[model samples]
Target chain A: MKRYFWLASYPKSGNTWLRLFLESLSHEGATPDINAMAFSGGHAAVRDEFERLLDIESNDLTDEEITRARPRMYELEAQAANAPLLRKVHDAWELTPAGEPLFPIELTLGAIYLVRDPRDVAVSLAHHMRQSLDQAIERMSNPQAMMSMSKRFIPKQLPQRLTSWSGHVESWLEAPVGRLLLKYEDMLSDPEAHFGAAVRFLGIDADRDKIAAAVEAVAFERLRSEEKARGFVETPPGVEGFFRRGIAGGWRESLTPAQVTRIETDHAAVMRSLNYL
Target chain B: MQGDLTLCGWRVRSALALPDLLPWLGGDSPVDIDISFGAIPTPAEPPLYTLPHSTLWADGRFLLHLEQVGKFWVEKGRRIVLEPAEHADESELRTFLLGSVLGVLCHQRGLLPIHASAVRINGRAILIAGNSGVGKSTLAAALGARGHALVADDITAFDTPTAMLLPAFPMRKLSLDVLDRLALPHQGLIANRPGQPKFHVPAADGFAPAPLPPSAIYILHTDRLLKSCAIDRAAPAMAMALLDRMIYRRAVGMKIQPPPALFLGLSKLARIAPVYRLRRAEDPSLHRLDALAEQVEAHAAVTRPLLAGSGTE
Candidate 1:
């Protein structure tokens, strides 16, 4: 049985960038299309694939029912995969209503969790969700913050329960699946060391030269320029673009001091553990 | 109450009240399918396809185990055996029976079921196809509100021999936001299932009971960057591929060895009828719905004369 790994992170943490780097590694000598990346095609929250795999309509099922079905859904996906699969996930590590881990542990090879500073996340998340800075901060601190949980209309993707940023990091850290933690700030500071470590964790036999080539292939400047020339399909409807200022600590310039304090106070414990504080 | 019903041109004898289907008016015609309350038999061998609550056997049998609902066995496209759970909502039980089970039956009978919501405009059926929750129902409802009669919602089964699109249930499964968006009252509307915001809105005003020959197929494509609606006619090759993707329960349908007639029917349908890519903004505003309906109507009108002259049917 071919197991899968999750490129797991809260929204606006460098999940997409890391995924692009992996895509670049596989498709050497060419720039990977930002829209058609492997992980992008297989998001954990995509509703269509779930419905197809289970032979059931998701709209007919309640949120609780959908949650209960999710673990087995991934198991089926694992069985169907010809090679090791990688899925992008925004949902926090949690249990289904049946008390089973949502991403079946036996079918999971590991999770590459990308942790970004909550303060920075709030700044980037505001732009991504089209929310004000204050609203974004509140969502980051909200224990029940959920994406696509709207009962009014069915969003394209399934409901992703992203608890507060602190809770999100802790959940994945303590999950039963094998964990390879890579901080977003560290990746930006030293791409060679951090990204190379990630490739090795995935059991890929790549030297530093290949890893550096993949990293250089997806530099933030190239990605931003690419999004400018040809619009990115993943960009939200009203958002200007997805690759907005792919730099760390933008909160210093973009966020109000009070806003920073809010994220800090809410997530200080987790931040201190990760040496963020 | 026993349900002696007709669904998509089949005589159905059901134990549950499948109110969505019309009464079986073909008095003496032998029942084509049976839906009974009974024990669901387990498959003798390992399932060909297995999910959390459902499994499909190699012999073309399907079993669905809905938590707190019931266990369902759909076998040979002729019989459906259901064992209702304690206090299971009848409407909930009927919902899956009509949807997933019926879709499997369509495949078994060698019919082409497209994942679409279709409406009859200018005396012919126009299928609006897309993935789930792409506003297929909402768009069909909008067209229906514009005096077009609804042919089907969700699953539009195409009968290959007659080259006609058999209408499914005369009901639109709409979410609360859609009801609010269309200003439809949900006061007496029954939710498809308990705890789900979707309601089963009966299409009594102008429900097309008889199968209508399909005239055009519109595949809904929403792009965030797109500012307005753009309808483009797809080439023959692309149309065939896109229409294949629109097959209802396509994954499950693949488990069944489809007859050669299914492909031949699809090819003929694609060759004659126009398949259009109806591109619209991902976040279409209120007025966009009306504009979309107008564009579709105008396009259908323009193509009618051309189709009449071709004599391809």
Candidate 2:
């Protein structure tokens, strides 16, 4: 079996940028229909895949039932042979009841973890959820509320949100897997360099020119425009767009005076470490 | 002599020949064992004139120092020699030591190791868990700077029996870049063999013994431009999702055979503690922490009475 590579991140922490860059590098020829891919939240593709395999609607089956019926589904999806199977998961690693990982850990050939400044993340999340930076920080500080909101908004398969900004990243950094840590600032500063490094780490071989072309092809602006035009939106059920503004450091302008101080106090060390504050 | 000892229902082989490694053997008992591989060092006693190997045992752990060799063990009366190689090229030995020594200790104690930064806010314990670089330490430090007690950083031990989160040994190793960002006082950086920048902070100023009752659990998510900060209750499914991400999921899974029961318990806990998704922009304002602290305190007060009756199965 070809090992799968997981592109993991906290929501809105430059995961899409890393994904697009990797997809560009791994592109053999022709743009594969992204709609056909299986994602954590969007149900259309999963339903279609299930119906095609078992001749049944997905809503009728529980997640357990789907797991039992997954082998056939996998076989059916494999018919579209040209594209490598790419799975996007937001869940953290945990073992199944059978003492096995919910997903196959051994099949995880590699992983790419993208980290961003939490202060910036807060700013972006505020805009995405239509909340103020102070409000976002306040909600985050309250572990109970954070858990409540996550239960309301995030999916069941995904991992629970950590109470602190730093706790979120530490989970993946300490995972027992080979992962390449990609900084969003570094990727934004020089997409070519970081993207190429990520591609190389994934064991994909492409010349510098090819990598450069791919990097240029998947610009953030291009993706945003593509998302807008194609209506390629995958927001949480009660939430908004997965892709908000693709710019960096918007928190400076977006956060209120009180919110800025709160975020600084909450994420002072992290912001300082990343030079965001 | 070799004997079989049952620990947590797992039968482990114990041999007397490996005396140096005996002190570290952990069980649910308080008995302390001591041994010596060669010359035994005593208090007020000079160094052994020509000792070949020495082993010291105290408390419940043992230390072995070999003159020409390093630490070694005899599994079954068969002498095993140990050689010390060059340190890791990119990571700190202290991290490894903590992970190995304390990690084993906690595992033996039926405690789960969690990847989180813990601190006390207004007498309530708050745990921050996320992937690396999500600003856990930064947030913990920020809260610490604001008078919240620092219980532990990077690793937290969840004491299942006590239904409390215990503080592991404290070692705050902040990067220089982080120090510069926070503008906090710190000693100079210590150059490990691989030359990674590690600065030390006083563990005494922040360390707290005994676990605090958990008040809230927040799953921190970042965004480029969040509109506002608000506290909302997490749905049962969402609560399950978040709990699934916790490091203790495996242990919990083992305990709760049918996962739905676990999810339901998490949902109840969610009800008892307010859970929220903290969203913000890339360059958010600094005062956000104050807002967060206020929200947390308010929520904790309301939930404390309700949570008092909630029991862990």
Candidate 3:
């Protein structure tokens, strides 16, 4: 049987970094080609996988219909998988319209939810989306915010509902499943300790030395250089880069006081719980 | 009212109106397939092959259930029974009927269904094949704009012995953005499903009805990092792999047909058709399509003389 796990997060929440580290860990301390991580399962919202597993064209279905079929898609994927699978997901943990969990609980081994300070996320997301800082801040706080939901063109991936930053955090934290939470700041400050914990949580049987090597292989500087060498595949067509300045608290310099206050105000209670306040 | 139609050379007598197929005009032939409204029984035994939303039983029975759409049961490749939802729209039901259900029927009958959109270039079929959303239909539409007649869209089935291409319905499915990008008129476009950006456009005048012999096949691909357009002729080994990957509803076909049988059909196609990989820089607006279309036409014209005596028939 194949065990499935989710690397869940809001956008730009160190999800890719964790995945990179896991890739290095699994491949015997070798840094993976940044552009070649497609074998690392894949994104949860990839339209091709949905269409392939469901045996129907996804463009013919509404977003609501797509969401309802996602759990089944994952179930079938896990059943057919020959090895353990780790899938990255940005959709907030919630129920479908039919009141079933959006992610199948029975097939999941666990989930690793990576979270970041919304103020800092706003800065990174602004660059990623090529939006003004104010626009990014507004989107971060909007409960109804969705990604890849374009009206004019059919997006490559299915629409993912990323509720308000706080809603996203709270939804994953409170969901009834096996889960581990890691802060981006904490991972940056102590890679060996945090990433080590995640490796052990997934029962990878890696020692501290192996975890340290994996961390060094995917260090922020190496990742940025690799991306700069040969453009990252995950970067959108017009985006300059995907791995920009991996740091915590860049919001202090990047965000105006008003923008910081808006994120804090919008996400105060959840931020307080996660110690982001 | 029952409608008599011919889809991919199969005489179909369907209770549902399949606006995509050509009306059956030939005299006195047995119906190859029958479709109607009926209650589909819930399978009590374990499914032989199962997808997320569909299943194929050991007895050659298939069932597909789409949320908010309906359930479809394809039995022995000869009949299709549908039990639609209370709020199912006619267009939504017909969309799956013509797409997935027909794909199943083709597999059951042991035909090679290539997931491609083809156009007739000088009365010879040139297929642009790829996965869904890879712009096969868009490229076919672009070729149509360049004076080529559309042979088929999405699912291009062929008779294995003669390697003759069967023309699908005279229609194209284009997303609203594609229509706007290509500047094509979208009047009377029927939405494939509510809230979906894709619409089915009637292409009656620009459609080619006759079965054409395969001349060339271009597998469409896009890369954001590509600096310029690249077209590479695929070797025989690579062509076999590409054609196998381009098989429509391949998993269902694999379950229905043995490997040697499938291999024989693909080998025949790979031997006869000249296949190439056509790549362009990814652009959502399809702005690069004009250049790509011109390149294809030029390549086909240059290769036409060589293929004329090749005897694809």
Candidate 4:
């Protein structure tokens, strides 16, 4: 009985465009392989996926001993899952440092979070971190803004604290008690009714021609012509693409009214409760 | 049980206490391996549980478990037991029993170990295969700061009927961001766990303790859009499929497989040494590893391996 969700976001919120519509839901006429998004399940800040789920290498631990060994490495990555995995967390709903609950909400079976518009996620997090739009709106209003904290090397993920874009969407929309939230401008104006209510909030029961063919099999002009014909190994090495401009209010044509008033006066009360004041 | 200690090139006899390693002083000693921490359990259960941190059942005896660290049972690979977990700590259960229970007991004694890192330049063995932060112990600590030796870390293993390249512990777990990006000096290192910024560095002098064979193998790939530094050479059918996917915990390397004469001795070690790839430029720039150790000491002085074509053909 392996099931775990969390696609949770805040780094250019739309979390890989809602993880390419949950990796094209349950494909029918096959358009899936947007570079093998075959049921995505990859990052939740990877430090070599908790040193491959505990064969252990955590580059000598401490980030609070790797968040107290991440709730038993997400409960043995949800009992070594056979089917439902999802993953992709951009860190924020944090806790462990001798506190607890750094995602072991009893082996979660829910979470999709997704949020956006911290002024179009500080212009797609300053072009997926190449940086600038006033340093990505001063690191989305830094509250100790982290992400691969790099002390020079050893950073293949697992440092992403990102506590500020309104405490990363109120820490995964106020954690615990199953979540689904979704709103990268409502999956860019109805990705078949917000990814078909996140595939019936993970119960999955579709309609409307298989949720409009898993929303035209993850369209954003076919993930920018498949990352302009294969280059995007999660891009961002002097970035040119990670599917940019998947349009949400172009931060009023590229923010600069002092970076859109420092992302609307430092995310004015979570952008006026997500209405983007 | 706090007695005998040799590491990665095992003779290990333990009950725990694997401090910064370094004890097994060479002499091709007859196999010993033994390690014990107490009553183990997990020697069966394995119906494809797909890795949540540990689980290997393998037919004739493998049983790896490893959840909160401990449950090892390496029966046919010459024995290892470890049970741990009751406040488990001896440098984090000997760092997951020296990586995937010493690379599944060096693939149950036939040894083809791989997930590499090696050095010994002049007397051969260059190696260095990748994929776990692809810097193979910061290029084997910049080829042991250019005096070259270091020979093996994170599982190199080979030595069966002298396919050579064995030697393993001289210390190099790294990651205090590769000792401040190779400016080195961590002063008698050793923090590989206890609030880990990963230390275990040690090697004030080249440490190749013996076993040689390899003459060139490369395969690294840091590439943040690789804009300089390339290295190439691989095709011999991609160096026999990157030595059948760089073995070490090669996901239960097919339950310690290595027979069929170890795939005809790794395709006669890909026609006796030569498998390049290399990449670079995920730039944290320590003079771009002084141009990747001057292109790996000019490709280990032009692909060594010719002490009269070191027999494989």
Q: Give me the runs in candidate 3 sitting further than 4 Å from their true place.
A: A38-41, B41-47, B303-313
Q: Against the true structure, whose DockQ is highest?
A: 1
Query: Of the candidates numbered 1 and 4, which has the greater TM-score value?
Result: 1
Best by lDDT: 3
Residue A78 Cα positional deviation in candidate 1, in Å, after optimal superposition: 2.1
Q: What is the interface RMSD of each candidate, in Å?
A: 2.0, 19.9, 1.6, 9.2
Ranking by DockQ: 1, 3, 4, 2
lDDT of 3 by residue, A104-209 (tens): 8887889999999888899999999999999998898889999999877677789999988888999899988899999999999998999998998888988888
Q: Point out the higher-scoring one by lDDT: 3 or 4.
A: 3
Candidate 1 at A124: error in angstroms?
Answer: 1.6
lDDT of 4 by residue, A119-167 (tens): 7777777788777778888887888888887654566777768778898
Tens digits of per-residue lDDT, candidate 3, B1-313, equal: 7568877777899888887778888768999889889899777899998776778898668888886889999988898999999999889999988888878888888778888998999778988998777789988988898899998999888767777788888999888878887788877788878767788988889989888888888898777667557889988899889888888888887888776777887777666678899887777767777888898898887654223424354
C-alpha RMSD of candidate 1: 2.8
Worst 10 residues of 4 chain B by lDDT: B43-52
- In model 4 chain A, where is the ten-residue run with the lowest total lDDT? A53-62
Q: Top model by TM-score, which number? A: 3
Cα shift from native, residue B175, model 2 (Å) = 3.1
Error of 2 at A114 (Å): 21
Q: Count the backbone clashes (under 3 Å) in each candidate.
A: 0, 86, 0, 2
lDDT of 2 by residue, B215-244 (tens): 666655544334435555566567557655
